[model samples]
Target: MTSPILLTGGTGTLGRHVVPLLRDAGCEVRVLSRRAHQPVEGVQYATGDLLKGEGIESAVDGAEVVLHLAGDAKNDEVTTRNLVRVASQAGVRHVVYISVIAADRVPLGYFRAKLGAERAVSESGVPWTTLRAAQFHDLVLTVLGKMTKLPVVPAPGAVRLQPVDSREVAARLVELTLDKPAGLVPDLAGPKVYSMPDLVRSYLRVRGQRKPLVPVPMPGKVGRVYRAGGNLTLEGADLGERTWEDFLAERVR
Candidate 1:
């Protein structure tokens, strides 16, 4: 029988979906979080952090595989190194990491961090699979929360994104966790790519807020990549079923 599966970032967006699927598959699930929490039916929670490497060994102990999903998008490289060190020491077999698409292309800090994290995981000497996917529709919501106040929204004009559903991405991660570690996989993306201005407008319309959109050209090489469709997969590899519109309409509630 497979040992319990250890999932980092279990309280975050992707892990919220992944935990249930693991349970549905009859795999024992353990989650590492910094806060104390009550246990779910088939899940256990342990307090931890990716920065300081706290509560890591106890989290991975007795687990057959580690879904190393914990990391700040800003400092993912450091987090990945810490987790890899701990998981390597714990003698865990397989590790499945959720990374962003085109991490190597964009010159943004966060994307660079993700690329650094991927390198750390790959060099950890542990059996590992790193899967990169397009941004999630929820990312738009996050952007809105950060950029918009009430009636005004400032964002990039030509930014193109292929946003996938978090649940579907989580499903793919669960599949990777159970399979043999296959190294870096092809990009997973939404059925269609949409511009940022259009997507944000659609979101605002749905939320009953038709805020005036100020399309400012984001300043940097990363902004250039955003304008050049760096976030999209040209070969149309592993297209997930949800469109940006479909995601906003159905899942945003």
Candidate 2:
């Protein structure tokens, strides 16, 4: 029998793609889920909870690689610290963590928590790789849906973003697991950059909504940071193939 590869967040947006990628690579995949379900072909589900540390040790046991993709958006720092401790104690050979690009540059509490999580992963004695990626197109889609309902999109002024496909990000994570652990690889971005208003307008056009776009400055220091391109990648690295337009087209129609 082959030792399994433990994947946290196996049922999440990226997890849906990563499971198939690992399977195609001929690696036995074990996913940590809150509840056990009918296992998919070439995939096993183990009951685990990020908050309670339930079923983590058993899931990590005898696994060659542990992909730590499960972190709470509300409490990312605490959840990450807990996961790191468990991974270290389990003697996992390789720990791969997914982080947000420009986490340090953004003063948003969410980004701060992610940065704290990255620090935890780096400090852990186990070999680890942290892959930072830009905001996903799906996330942007959600934002567009919400903002379109309002009379104005409340577009942050001059905020630059490079949204990547979640699948591409997941594929990179799977590739990283196959190779030796490299610490803090260059950030991944989408094929192009778009401003907040531009994205909103594009979304509106695609949806055939004629809502007047009242572009307004985002409030607070975090909004200022976002306007300063807090979410963009300045360093060139891995660029995904999918564009926001591509995602928007499929969803709009």
Candidate 3:
């Protein structure tokens, strides 16, 4: 029997999509999460905390491939380092990591953490594959939802975003996890890029609401980086088919 593939962040938005796909491909999956879950066919749950470095050895033991999808707004570097150390010690064959596009270019703490996580994966002395993807449609929607709640929505000036569908990213990740380790594959982004105001306008139109949009200038190095499109990958990147309009049409009432 083939060994089960260990998956971190199996309970997250991306991991939720990946687990079913891996199972459909005739692969046993072990999901390492912080919480316990009810039993499911062809899927096993391993309760562990990557940040606290607990129960990782048992989670990684006997797993040939480790699909690490777990991440957060902070502490991703520390969590990834913990996972890499255990996976390395377990002799895991392949370690697949999902990162954000321009993780190294963006001058933010979150981006720095992501880049640090990437380094941890690459320097783990194990075969690894990393794929950087643009912001997810779900995340964009969440941010827009919160911003639009305010009386006047604040749109960052000269900032644009390419929000890809999570399903498409999940499919690509599963393919990489199944294949050999190909270090730093092409970036994945949405088909179209939308300025901050345009994105806000679309959200307002979808919800049949109107609000004043104030253009807020992003300041300092982060602003300059965003204005220069540091968070984007225009060429030599794989684009997803779904657009923000398509996502809003389906998700919004």
Report the number of the highest-TM-score candidate: 3
List residue ranges in candidate 2 displaced over 4 A.
Answer: none
Error of 1 at 202 (Å): 1.3
lDDT of each: 0.84, 0.85, 0.95
Residue 109's lDDT in candidate 2: 77
**TM-score between model 1 and native:** 0.92
Evaluated at residue 38, the lDDT of candidate 1 is 99
Which wins on lDDT, candidate 2 or candidate 3? Answer: 3
What does the lDDT come to for candidate 2? Answer: 0.85
Q: What is the per-residue lDDT of model 1 for residues 1-253, given as tens digits with 9 covering 90 to 100? A: 3688999889888999999999999998989898999998889988878788787878878887989777686789887888888889989898889898998998878888989999998999999999998888788768866666656787678688878888899999999998999999888888887787877777777777767888788777767777787767879479899777776777556
Ranking by TM-score: 3, 2, 1
RMSD of 3: 0.8
Off by over 4 Å in 3: none
Model 2 vs. true fold: TM: 0.95
Q: Order the candidates by lDDT, highest first — what do you get?
A: 3, 2, 1
Over 1-253, each residue of candidate 3 has an lDDT whose tens digit, in order, gives 2999999988899999999999999999999989999879999999999999999999999999999999976999999999999999999999999999999999898999999999999999999999999999999999999999999999997899999999999999999999999999999999999999999999999999999999999999999989999889999999999999999999999
- Evaluated against the true structure, the overall lDDT of model 1 is 0.84
- The pairs that clash in candidate 1 are none
